[model samples]
Target chain A: MGIGPVAAQLEALLFVAAEPLPLPRLSAAVGLPERQVRTALVELAAHLEAGGHGIALSEIAGGFQLLTRPEHAAVVAALQAPRSAPLSKAALETLAIVAFRQPVTRATIEELRGVQSEGALATLVDRGLVAEAGRADSPGRPFLYATTRQFLEHCGLRSLEELASLANLPPAVTQVQPLPGWRTPARGAAGPEAATPDA
Target chain B: MGSDDRGGGVPEKGACQAPEPGLESVWSGLDAGTLAPDDVRVEALVGQQREVAADLEDATAAVVQLSRVLEAKARALLPTPVAPEAEGGEPGAEPDADDADLAERVAAYQAFAEAAALLRSYEESRALRFGRPQPESKTRRPAPSPAGAVSLEDLLTALSQVWERARPRTRDVTRERLTVGQVVARLRTRLSRLGSIEFEELFPSDADRFEVVVTFLAVLELVRLGEARAQQPHPFQALRLAWSGPEAESR
Candidate 1:
């Protein structure tokens, strides 16, 4: 195929891809040389940048992907508002572990929670709530996890201490009173019909 | 009472009796009026007990005083330095440029010190597990023997042979060689990463001395020979000398 057709195809593939695509994989899919694919990607990225659409191609985690410019994050967040749910209980628990036991391994979280937490961990990572800090020195060298700055912003904390203090209640109490809004009914307040007997 | 005096003391009625064999009988024979005049032993025992009590009280007082003095001295010795605060209501405000720069330098130094300490401990532990090599001076080079002992020239030839054997059998190969300029470049790059030179450690023998000119020059020479590489990941980080050989690529 000519370079023009190949570049068009590459752009189309990137636009619809849910995750970043590696150059090798993209080359294989498009049946083009790796060098040619890279050149095309560079050209495409520049074209997008100059277009002023607030979307740019980025290299992350060894792959190329399109991402919204950070300056447009507020607008994107507003558009995504109704689709989002309040933080799940499991997510909160995982976040707590990440915040306090930061630079901790996945095994440590499993040990503390007494259950498999892979799904919750992945979810937190996907949401940018946590990140891979580094690898531990032990055998197999598992990746250490830590809460990201987004997590701090979400929790309304200027620092990790504020988050840690959430778990630092005096030992005398067996149960803690939930924060004021946390105790509200999972569903919106009972409907008026439920409060009154049916006619 | 009627007194019947016969000579000096017409043997007072009780005294006239023979003294008893034991203390009880002797006490019974003695008049109660005369006993009080001979109570010297009781007074001596009481005085001894008083002296012992006073000594014990003095020792305890001395111990308490010593403890207080020691505590005060300890407090004076290591008083926590008060952190200078910016005159404002904002807590944890961004530090001024000078303070920020100093803190960065200090943090870098602390990290380097910690890493060096860890490396030293690891080396010590490894040495303990595996016996250390004897001093180089103790091992003497063998004298060359005809057709028996290898001479220095022969040794060099053998080393070259080994190197030739190890060379990769591929075209378009990149031969990594170290040069003085390369070493200088690496050092400059590494120094940029390092927080600052630890002048004290670099020149412990001379306090007034600041820079490490000669030692650094020697390091550059070593790096030029491919014996060492300067490794530093970030600014304000410590420079590390690492051995880079063919085997190191695997690591």
Candidate 2:
């Protein structure tokens, strides 16, 4: 049959939304319970898919938004605009590390790659793939970085769960856990569990 | 000293300007024909010549000494054992010629490597035109991390930052607080029962830090408006507050 009034309202609201709209906000606006609104979003996503519409609903960036299908990228490119140039090699590697080990800090990345990654981190953040999640609880309050939903979209992964395990890399990669300069990756001179002077 | 030696020696400015008394007398004798003696004039001229020759000898020795010192210094300044290769290159080239060459070679190699990679990428991408425009997704690049010359202080700062971010954020859940108006009303009610009350009594045991602060402020405001009187028994003592009479209120 036709789309229900609640589902139709959700579609219209999401279409007009510039940012992702959470279920609670959508439910509040539609005067329905959050569970009902969530079910409606599910049915709405499926209905759009069944109808073979160019636009589809996807939950991203902690909320739901309408996006053009991947098959329509070339068509949308014609309608919208060309994508920007790709990130540099340094940026890609940094992004991979961030995507795999999210809520990470630049220091930790530097220790792992045996390099300073401020510039790469900044680039990934600018591209909207990696973002500042929060400040670490340690001194200087360095920002903790996490992969954005845009990161998954960029990688063509549905979620972080789909990220290929970095476990395949040397046992050393996982051993480089969080700490001061976390000096184990490059400077594997010291044992991974070596204590910091302050500790 | 010979009389002819005067002409051989370089003349001194002071000697030229002012002749010696004996020489002047000799010249005057010659000019005025008073002494009428050519021998005296010859002797005086010989004496002056002798003096000038001695001064010239001393000056020449000084010049030789100064020349020797300057030559020694110049020898010391010359880059000893200058590399033949450096000398053959452009005159006054940078001392570290090898470093400069290495830098140039590195830059050229980097350019060539980048161009080669681009050519390969272009060929690879041309085949998969329909694929998503995700750049460099599968092709892993070597980590271009620097010499990881991180200092201990920097590492510690970074470590602390990591630890701090990982620390659980104490999400302070705030509760409803009594406003100044509410505190004032409550204080007034409390004071009505007891004509005077201790300042500490305003804060009930259940009162949180915020409530205590608000209650204290409310008490100060009441006293400021002359609505109440707060008196301390002595310095560093608990303050007692009472209702201000009409006189205190008028003030």
Question: In order, what lDDT does every prediction score?
Answer: 0.46, 0.54
**RMSD from true fold, candidate 2:** 30.4
Clashing pairs in 2: A135-B165, A136-B164, A136-B165, A137-B164, A137-B165, A138-B163, A138-B164, A138-B165, A180-B159
Candidate 2 lDDT by residue in tens digits, B1-251: 11222222223445663343333243233334443332243434454545643344333322332333233334435655444455457644555565345434333322322332332343233222222233464223222121232435567899999998896778878787679889888877667656678877778889888888888899988888776888887999888998673444333
Task: Give DockQ per model, in order.
Answer: 0.01, 0.02
What's each prediction's TM-score? 0.25, 0.36
Model 2: how far is B188 from its true place, Å? 75
Docking class of 1: incorrect
| Tens-digit lDDT track of model 1 for A132-175 | 65567799989876655345333333344433343332221112
lDDT of 1 by residue, B195-223 (tens): 23342333336522222454566466756
TM-score of 2: 0.36
lDDT of 1: 0.46
Candidate of highest lDDT = 2
Clashing pairs in 1: none
